[model samples]
Structures are given as C-alpha cells and as structure tokens.
Target chain A: MASATELRRTPLTALHEDAGARLVDFAGFAMPVQYEGILEEVGRVRTVGGLFDLCHMGRVRILGERREEAAQFLVHPNISKLKFGAIRYSFFCREDGTTMDDVLVYRDTDEVFFCINAGNRDRDIAWMREVVARYDCELQDLSDDLAMIALQGRASVDALAPLCTGEPPEPVRREGATGPAALKYYSFMRGSVCGHEAMISRTGYTGEDGYELYFAADKAPEIWNALLETGKSAGLTPIGLAARDTLRLEAGMALYGHELDDTTNPVEAGLLPKMVKHTHDFSGRAALEAAIAAGPQRRLVGFTTAGKRVPRQGYTLHLPGDDGGAAIGTVCSGSPSPTLDTIIGTGYVRSELAEAGRTLAMDIRGKRQDVTLVEMPFFKRDY
Target chain B: MSNPTDLKYTASHEWARLEGDIATLGITAHAAESLSDLVYIDLPAVGDSITAGEAFGEIESVKAVSDLKSPVTGEVTQVNSGLEDNLSVINSEPFGGGWMIKVKVSGDLPADLLDAAAYDELAAADAH
Candidate 1:
C-alpha cells in the first residue's frame, strides 16, 4: 500500500474533501470510498442516480492509418466490424490465453480509444507500445490530460441530456431525436458539456442507463459541480468507490484483480464465446480455441448464502460433506447487496459443480456455510 | 459524541461499566463510527471466559472486519442475542443499547484503562 503522501490526487479531490467523504488509497490514488454510507449510496443509485469520479482510470488513444489493424491484433473483439462511435467491452490477452487487462474499446472517426484499468495503466501502455511498434499506429496516453465521470441510473438520461449543448456526433444521431436521447447504449458522441468540449458515451459499470463524460482535466471541478446542481431535482448525488463496488457486484460485472488476473484466462472468467471474435487471427486465438475445445476446467459462478455474512475474496469453497477435506473453488468478489437485500458472491468452482442448483460450502472464518449457486446478475433493471 | 466519564475505556476502543462484581461491556462510539454501517456481529456465549486485551467477539462492516477486544478478565454472564439481527444499534447507540455482554469479573481490572478525557485525546489523534 502507498503512504498517504505518496498517493495521487484527482482534480476533484477538493470537492470530495469538502463533502466529508471518507477517502482511501485505491490503485495508488487518493479516492473517496464513501460520502454518507455504502448502503444508502447504493440505494440512491438504484432509485435515482449517482455520479462517479473515474479520472484515475487509464485512457489511451491509438492513432494513425493502421489503428484498426493494431486494435484488431491486440484485443479479443474484431475491431473491423465495430461501427463508428460504438464502444465494445473487450480484453487484452497474452499468447497463453491468460488475460492482461479488460478494456473498453471505443471506435471513433479517426482513432480508437481504449479505457484500461487504473492499476494496469503503465503496464498496458508499455504493452500497447510494444505491440503497435511494427504497425503504423502510435500510442498516446491521455490519462492525465482527460477527466472522466459517470452518471448512472434509470434517471441518467434525464439528468445528462440538458447539459449536452452542441449537436450529437454525426454517426450515432437519429433523425427525429437530439442530444443524449438520440444516442444508444454502447454509442458515443463528441459534443459540448457546459461550454466545454466533451465526449459523451452511453455506457457504465453499474448496469444502468447512463453516460460517461470525458473532458479536459482542468474543467473537472466545473463540470462535476454543474452536473450535481443541474441534476439535483432528479436526486443525483456523488457516489464513492464503495457503493460502486457493491453495485457492480450486484450487476455481476467482473472486476480486475478479483475476477481477472495475469494467470486467469478469459474462458474460465466466462467471457469467451460472446466477448471474443474468432473470425480473424488475434493474440491468444489458438490457445483460446484449444481451451474451448477442451472445455474450461473451472467456471465462474454466482452464489447466495442463507445468512448475512459476506463471502469475501479468497475464501475457500468445498463440497457439502467435504468441508475440511479438500477445496474445490475460491471466491472472487462478494458483498451485501443492498438492491436485493441479501449476501451475494461470485467464485470459481470446478466445471461440474458450476450449475445453478448446486450447493457449495464456503469456509467462512473457520466455519462451513452453505452457499447456493444462482444465476448471475443478482439484480437486473426492468428496462 | 462524548465518551461517558463514569465508564472506563481501553486503547482498543472497548468500554466497561462496573457495578459490584459485574461489568457491562460495549464498544465506544468512536469505534462504531470508524467501522461504519456494521452488518454483523459475533459475540461470545454466556458462561464463556474472556481475558483482558484479548478478542472475545468479532464485528463486521461492509468493507472491513475487526475484533472486539475485552477490557477485563471475566466470565460472560449474558450475551446480547438481539444484536445479530439488529446490528445498526451499534452505530446508533454504541454506549447504550449496543452493550455486548455482562461479565462477572474474576480478577482485578487492567491497570492501563484510560478515563474519558484521555480516551477523547487518543480518539482525536486517531481521527487525524
């Protein structure tokens, strides 16, 4: 862990401090963990909306004429088929089929934007630079120059539409609609936000209808305060990293360092057939194909315990009667889901025991607790 | 919130109220606030023996788990059985309804227990 003095601060750090948020060291950055309370913040996001400071996450732009080819070679998704102004959730994997980092790839008009994890920023940049050296593409680290924010919930569209003053980016606009209302999920547009140039993408990690705005680093405090004021009637409040984690866990979203690591493959993490496009050759294609052929030895699954004890990361899982005998799996992420009012968790179990009805015994603090495997996405919006 | 001057406090954040041979044990408001939104608590059963400076229970919040250290050596005479289902009391009434156990002291209380004023200073330093 980094010391308090050594931690990096975001541009909106003062606003968080002013709000009396409990700040913690996250990914080497001094970020807010919670402002009011975790359960209350989660409830607010589910009912109305919440804003997040995501500027610490890495943003890289790949430019040059061969940008598409470079992205196609480095990521799991086929970049050639992605339309302009669309964002795809993809991963950068190694030759051995293990994941390096999960990324969000946005196809812009002249360049490709990749949003990487905060902890893997430096390593991801080096990896991209090393791979794109042979091609005509050049990598530019835009992490420090841009500030990112997410406005997410069912009321997100209502809160964000009024701030986009300029015309929507040409490719994603509908004929009769304008502003954020015209944009679809996984699509983005370059426009003006409170008189500042910004790129608004209709995407989020909370599994809600939301938009992620990217703008100049210096204009962060202005834009952040503006959104809070404008969206006040809609109940939009500043959300911290703690509620963000519980929200994503309830949504069954994979988090880096928990569900994914350098040694875990995309297949076992449940991102293979749907997230990976095998049409053209990409890194780890052969190994992924072979793993698919052989079937994943272990599978990621979601489970619920009868009690309120949270099944945290690294807890061991075993068969019903094999409590002290041998371990069969390990928990990845777990939390008390305020949306569902239950203790929910995700873990990797042996292939045969990954079914929904199967029961596994989780070793929680030297005691065996029965956890029932359930279909993931513990909570889903009605849409 | 101010610590009760009538009770004794330990550096680990536990508070004890002595009456005759029995001592009522609970965590301080500073401790509960630092833990924040507790979800569960595990307390020792009645008739169990606990030692000073040793953990006799565990408390869990959404993001963290911490030990509840005992302030005096004693045998538990009662346990707050309702606390498992109503963990919020610890956050709302850390010194009152949140009492964890009633122990009959078998030995002298620890010598290092601090008064309310000393605990206030220690907690202030911790908040920084």
Candidate 2:
C-alpha cells in the first residue's frame, strides 16, 4: 500500500480527513471510501440526503464550430440535436466493438464538456485527440481546473434550491422560482451557488431527485462546507464511495470497470437501448451493427438471494440448486441493500436467462445459493 | 474503553483473556473500529480446534473481508450466536457483548502476545 503522499489528493482532501473519513487509494487518488459508516451513510441518502465529492472524475472541453459533430461521432449517443445547456450519457467505444469509457457530454455555451471516468481519463482524452483529426475541433483537458459535488436524495432540492442564483429552467423551478417546483430532472443552470460560481445540474447516479454542482477546484472547501451547513436542516450528510457504489448498483447504472469493459459491448451491458440505433460510420458502428444482427449472446440482469448471502464479482452463476454445475454468468456488482434488507446483485448471463422470473444460482466460494432474476433497479425511493 | 489493559492482544487484533484452561476470545476495539460497519462474521463452530496464529474465522464489513486469527491454540467451547442478526455490535462493544468464541486451551499462549500498551503502539503507528 502506498503512503498518502504517493497518491493524488483532491482539493477537498483536508476536509475529508478532518471529518474522520476512511480514505483509500482509488483510481490513483486518495479518496474517502466511507465516512461515518456505509450503512448509516446509505440510509441517510435514501431517506434524507447526502453530499458526495466527485473530483476524481475527469473533466475536459472540446471547442470548435464542428465540436458537436466531432463529439457525436466519438460516443454512442447521437448528440447532433442535443440542445445547448443539455447533457447526454454516452460511451466512447473502441473500433473493435469494445468499450473505451462511458462519458457525459455537457453541451456548454462555447464548448462541449466531456465528463470521463478517472480510470479512463487519459485514454479517453488521447482517443478523442486521435479521432479529432477527422473533424475540425480542439480538445483541452480541464480536470485540474474543476471540482464536482453531488447533492442527493428526496430533500436535496429543498436545501439547495435557495442557493442557486438563476431561475432553474421551467418545470424544475425551485422554491424561489415559484414553489413546489424542483430543477426539472437532468436540466442545469449556470449561476452562483453558495457564493461560488457553479453549474448546477439535476443529475445523479443514486437514482434520487438531486443535483450535481461543478465549480473551481480551489474553491472546493468553501462550497463543500457551505452545502453541509446549509443542508443541516435537510439532513444532508457526507457520503463516501461505499454507499455511492451501492446506490449506483441499486439504480442499475453501469460502472466503467465492472458492468462494461474493454471486452464488452454496450448491447450486452443493457445500453444499446439508449444508443443511437441508426447506422452511421461512428467508430465501432459496423461491428456493433454486426453484433446486433448476430444477436447478443449475453445480457445484463439483476438478481437477489435469500438471507445475508451477497453475490460477489467473479462468482460463477449456475442453474438453481447445488447440483447445477455449468456456469451461466458472472456477478458484476453486488451489495446487501440497507433500505431493502436483501442481498442484491447484477450480472451478465446468456440472453435466454434474462427474463425477470427465472431462478439462477451463484456459487458463493464453494456453496451454491439460489438467486432469482428480478427487474432492474433493486431499489426505488418513495419520494 | 478501546483496549482493556487486562486482555492480551495478537498482531491480527484478536484479544484473549485466559482463566486457567479456558480463554475467552474477541477482537480488540482497535480492530473493530478499523473494520467499521461489520456486515457479517463467519465464526468457528463449537468443538472446532484452533491453532495459534492461524485463522479461525472471517469477518466482513462493507469495504473488506478479513481473517480473524486465533491467539492461542484451543478447542472452541462456545460461539456468539448473536452476531447472526446484529453484527454491528462488534463495532459498538468489541470488548464486551461482541465476544466471539470461548475456547478450552490445549497449549500455552503465543510468546508475542501484546499487552494493551504494546497494541496501542501498533495502532498508533497505523494512524499515521
């Protein structure tokens, strides 16, 4: 294990340490894996609210008249008609029909902002740079310049709405905008929040009504501290990666290194439905088309088992009961849900076994336990 | 409250209190706090023999799963039945209600068994 100095530290590193967080080396950066505790943090986010430091995620800008065209060709989503001041979830794929990195394209006023995963930050930038020669555009890595904070849960808007300066776009209005109106989901506004310039967007991985705020890295402590103080009445606590993983897993959202990888295609990972189905010469378009025509051999499915048994990664999935020996799939992400009181997991299996009612089995270490395939999103908020 | 001076600790963080041939086994509070938010513990069954410095059980929390090594060779005389429903007690009362296994010792304790002061030094070093 490397010492703290050996790993990259975010601007908010001091704040996390001051809060007594359990910091761990994650994706080359020293990040808090849990603060307070996973169960307590997860419960708070599901019921009341929580804030997350997402500075480790990559931030970059693509600028040019043909920026939109160049950006659209790089990812799965067709961003040609993406309105300015909007965001799109996309995947930058390799020419071999494999995933490179999943990204979020922010249609900023002057440039297209790319939010890439920390693990794939450099690779995504280099690949985009390599492909930009085909079009007219310039790519700039802006990771060191910005920091991101995610405010999540049912009560988040009630606490943060007053801080945003500009009137949130219609339908997603705040109490100040009118009353009872929240930032329309997935919409964003450029304004001053907590006395700091911010781009607040109603986007989150927790599957809750929430917002993600982006601001200057140097001002991270001020913004983070302000959110905590302002949100105290709304029950906002600082959550860490452990709860973040469980929250995203329960939402059926795929993580970069887990559900999707270099060897996997979006079609098999339950992302093709969100992809642009039309045939264009996008990278891996032909291979993805070929894979589509041949039919996906495997598809991602969510499952749960009885008792406290959790399905873990690399665990082989088999037919129900102990005698069922052949492997069907492998677990990608799993957690014992704090809200649901059951062990839930998601994995990819033969397309034939993707049905919701079928019973599968997981070889836990050496013991086989019954796992019933269920609908995606193991959790749903009452709010 | 974290490390009782009366108990002896192992480098793996298990604490032992020997009363003649019987030794009560539990993890130190330092170990419990380090594990944090324990979700499950797989303990040895009654009558299972444990070897000193060898793993007798495994404890799991949200972030990791770690082995619980036995400090003294012994036969498991009793096991805590309470952790099945509430494993969080290990973090709350690691020295008291969280006692994991009671054993009947077959041999002497390990020579490297640490007193509370010695274990504190180890934990203190880890803090930095």
Candidate 3:
C-alpha cells in the first residue's frame, strides 16, 4: 500500500506469500514475521525442527592471498588463529570502543566469508573496505549472490542428514584422538545437500543443535521445498522472523541495536571473554583497552517478571524501594517465552545490581512491577 | 469469527450485551485475533466501579499488552474468574465463554455504540 518501491524481497518471498506468512518490513526487506503464530513456530524449533529464511542476512566474501589477514584485522577475536573450515563469532567495532556489528567469519580453503547483519551490511561493507585497504585483499559483496537457511532444533539433524551426501569430517576433539561429534558447534563442512553444493555450518543463533545451510540464491525454493518434504516426519515447520527473535532472546543472544551499539562497549555487554588478549592494532582495540582500565560502569543482566506483566523494550527499570527508588536500566529484549511459559527479558543495569536474585522493579507502562534479576539462557535444550 | 449481532460494540473493539439491568462485556473476535496467543488477562475485581471509555483491566499476548476499556459506565458485579485457569478462551471463544466481566448498569447505554454491521465496518477500516 505504501508503494512497494523501496523494500527488497528475498528469493523465497513468493513461497512465503503462498504459505500465508505475515510479511513485515525488516531492515528494508519485506520478510515473513510469522506464518501461523510465534508460539507454535518457536515451539517447533525447540521441540522439533524449524526452517528459517536467513536470506535477509549479508554474506560477503573476502578473496586474494591476504584474505585471512584482512578478515583477522577487522574484528577483536583471534580470527587469524581460526582453523580451516572453522567459524568464529566476533564483534566488528568502531575505533571509539563501541560495536559496529556482531559477525560470523568463516575460514574456508580459498576465501574468508562473513555473515553480517542485514541492516548494517552497507555500513559494515564500507568499514571492511576501509580496513582491508591496508592489506592485500579483494573484498566483494556476496549477499545478493547467496541464500541461507537455518534448520534448527533437536530434530534438525535427523531431518537434514538424509539430504546431505556424506558425514561431516571429524573435528579436533578434546583428546589425543578425533571423530565427528555432532558437527562440533561452530564449524562447517562443504557437502551436497539435495544435490546442491552447500556449506553447512553448525553455527546457530537460537542456542539449539542445528545447521545453517548456504548456497546459491536461485536454488532456495528447491532446497526449501525439499527440506520441508524430507523433514515432514521430523515435524519440520517453516519458521519466520518473529519466532527467531523470541528464540534468540530466550537464548540470551543480543540483537545488535538492542544489546550492542556504537555508544556501548562490549565489556559492558558481558562479552569480555570474546576479546582475545591482543597486541595488534585492530579497530576499537586502543579505546577498548582504555575502557577496560577505567572499568565498565554497567553490566548486562537477565530479568523476569511475574506471569501477568511482560517487561517490554524501553521499559525503565528501578531498584524497588520506598526512598525515591533509583533508576537502574532499560529493558532491551522482552517477550513471553512459550518454552518457559512466563515473561522474560534482558537488559543492562548498574554493575552492582547485575547479580542474580536481585530485585528490580520494571516499569510496565506506568506501573512498577516486580522483576527479578536472574541468569540468562532461560531455555536450554538437553541435546 | 463473528461478533454476536445482539451485542453492542465500541470503537476500541469491546462488546457489551445488556441483559435487563446488567451488561456482560468481552472483547470482540477482531480484538481477540489481534491479541493472538493470549497469555494473561487482568480482569477488574468484583464490586469495583468502572467508567465508560476508561481502562478497567489489561490483556496480554506474547507480542504486546493492551488496556481493556469499559464500554458502559457501571459497577463491576462479577469478573470472569474461570478465565484465570484457561486464558486460551480469549482467542478461541471471545464472544462466549471468554466474556470478561459483568456490570450493573447505573445509567442509559452510551450513544456511540455500534451494531454488528457498523462495528465490522469499523474493524475493517481500522485494519486498512
């Protein structure tokens, strides 16, 4: 109705429409927010398998001899030390000690691939170009050239393994010997799935045992339908962005703008472990070192409300008391988790108040309801 | 999903049915559908006074929370206590067992209340 002149559509847009998905504008792309419902879809991903249209994410390939070096220099993590066919989750940050975006870097035999946020693709690509200019690397935007589907849950492997031709190569196990152990969570293998060459990665955002399949954009519908057909017995359902958000939130994974941003450093985001002990001059390294010396004043924590009230984003949090209660933080991601069967959210609060079991009052609309600070990753899969 | 023809509707998607001196109120089918997967509904206590067009309760779905505004000014005689155990009725049978509250009418019915046809038109327009 707003003149479909601006928003981009993914390759599976027609299929989503046919399946009666409720499409909404996400990062300038018309994407499916939900099909049947968030509760049912997300429940499917947790119990059985659920397929996701991750075509909205950006995929960039870095080529040439110094590709690994170029990719290593941009992020804070030790990407240079990553083994072949391995993926590292790293934060791309500005020089001012704040995050630009959280990205996944893949080390392949020939090229380094980056999975970046769709909304920050243009900015991240520009930043990457600036960083790689110093190294002997050729950068190319492959986002439009690729389509990604994340099949996640306990039932995912049972659904996906039948399509893939061979078993993934054995990963470096935690002993003197080695064998494939559930694909070893952050690694990938190149194999044929549904007769199409796919880079299947164990990396996932939903904190489930799953696989992310990447291939040519044109082959999306074929793979989508094939997976659905093959996975019907495993109860594989087509999931949408709304359920993705809820699943990731329940897993305590941060959304870029909500949990990490240009104004906030990673230390406050409870991601200091991700920052390797580095001497190299990476973007944000110097400012981050300085911030560490001064100590981050706030910390990210998980909070849950009593069953009736849902603490939504931007809700002001305060320490519950009578003496002009002190404001503490703001709710970043909030929703009623179908898995947990209650309201849960994550937010940043003063470092001292970030402990579990602490009581905080979350202002839901005008009422200050009781919210308890608790450990995150609210739902964990046994598998 | 259809709103009962005998019930009076408000612009905010509330439905009220007058039975002698008392009125039973609940959200319409359109409103229930919008609030899919209803998790909680905070109904007003019995004997509480309610004002027309003012929020007397709250309803929550996974996506959002909305205030439940009263359609007619009166005293709340009975709250849907059974709905506390089974909230799915709000989405499944909003016009029947999902009825939220009963109020004793203190005065004449509000003037702007719409019939079924008019309410459906308003719901359609609001969607657009």
Give the top-scoring candidate (DockQ). Answer: 1
Off-target runs (Cα >4 Å) in candidate 3 are A1-7, A133-136, A166-182, B18-22, B104-115, B118-128
Tens-place lDDT per residue, model 3, A45-151, is: 88887899999999998998887778877877666667777888778977788999999888888998899999899999998988787786889898888899998
User: Candidate 3 at B124: error in angstroms?
Assistant: 4.2
Q: What residue pairs are clashing in model 3?
A: none
Error of 3 at A148 (Å): 1.2
Q: Is 2 or 3 the stronger prediction by DockQ?
A: 2
If scored against the real structure, what TM-score would every candidate get? 0.95, 0.93, 0.89
Error of 1 at A343 (Å): 1.2
Model 2: residue A244 alpha-carbon error in angstroms = 1.1
Model 1 regions lying over 4 Å from their true place: A1-5, A167-171, A174-176, A274-280, B111-122
lDDT of 2 at A111: 79
Per-residue lDDT tens digits of candidate 1, residues A177-274?
Answer: 77887887888888888889999999899977899999999999999998898789988999999999999999989998989889888889887744
Docking level of model 2: acceptable
Scored by lDDT, model 3 comes in at 0.83
Better model by DockQ: candidate 1 vs candidate 3: 1
DockQ of each: 0.59, 0.47, 0.38
Maximum-lDDT candidate? 1
The number of the candidate with the highest TM-score is 1
Local accuracy of candidate 1 as per-residue lDDT tens digits, B25-116: 99999999878878889999999999999999998899877789999999999998999999999999999999999999987889999999
Local error of candidate 1 at B113, Å?
Answer: 4.3
TM-score for predicted model 1 compared with the true structure? 0.95
